[model samples]
Target: MNNGKPAPYDARVITHYGVLGLGFFPQVYYYWYKWLDGRYVGTAARTVVKKLLLDQFVLTPPLLVVFYVSMSVMERKTDLFEECRNKLLPTFKTSCIFWLPAQALNFLWVPPAARVIYVGTCAFAWVNILCWIKRQDY
Candidate 1:
């Protein structure tokens, strides 16, 4: 609005009903992380960093790719890869800052059974961030 360019609303990944599906991703991924992370409990700091870094480096890239490409499809765009290229870096950097401490809390203190719910709470906020990111005029 300030810049005179209309905010790109429809291209956002977290569209009205799309939020429900995106919410499922974090919960599901949390369960998958719990299973994949297994029972090898390490030093508290080390374990938190491991979980954060793995989630950052491994999970985020693929998810960003999927998110951008899928959002493009939802937008009825022809060039999905272009959408990914336009949004990936800024989104990934912001995601790192946001998710690092969020996941650290989940890994360190949250019980296994509540992990999904814990992350779902954070995901609720993150979707807002994603909406903000996707709507930027970049």
Candidate 2:
């Protein structure tokens, strides 16, 4: 909702999130977990730290870009980058706050095969946060 108004229902929005949840995110998480599992064989503490670092630095920034851009496109906005330009940093900052500890726990306890599902579970809430951020005027 924007300014306390409910967002108009759009199937594209539903499809966009559905695709992300069913296809894009699962693939990304599976590969990320696989790579982290393969690359970091140190102590669990060290591995979780490394995973969190990569998650916060490498993966999240671009993911936020994608989120904003895709949402803009799905909304049929003329300027795809406007929302991204205005909101990416703040959204990413919020995401860092949310995902850091969540991913740390994911890396620590979630096994390779279940990592995507775990992240999907987390993404349920994260998506709501993203929606809220997207609707904000900043």
The candidate that wins on lDDT is 2
Local distance difference test, each candidate = 0.76, 0.83
Highest TM-score: give the candidate number.
Answer: 2
Candidate 1 Cα misplacement greater than 4 A, ranges: 1-31, 39-43
lDDT string for model 1 (1-138, tens) is 459887766535436336544554766586677764684364388777877787889888888888878767777888868868988999999999999889888788887777778877997799779878878977
For each candidate in turn, the TM-score is 0.79, 0.85
Residues 25-129 of candidate 2 have per-residue lDDT tens digits of: 677777877887788854478777988999899988887887778777777899999999999889888999999989888887777777778888999999999
Model 2: ten consecutive residues of lowest lDDT:
17-26
lDDT of 1 at 67: 80
Report clashes for each candidate as comma-separated counts. Answer: 0, 0
Task: State how far residue 75 of model 1 sits from its true place (Å).
Answer: 1.3
Model 1: which residue pairs collide?
none
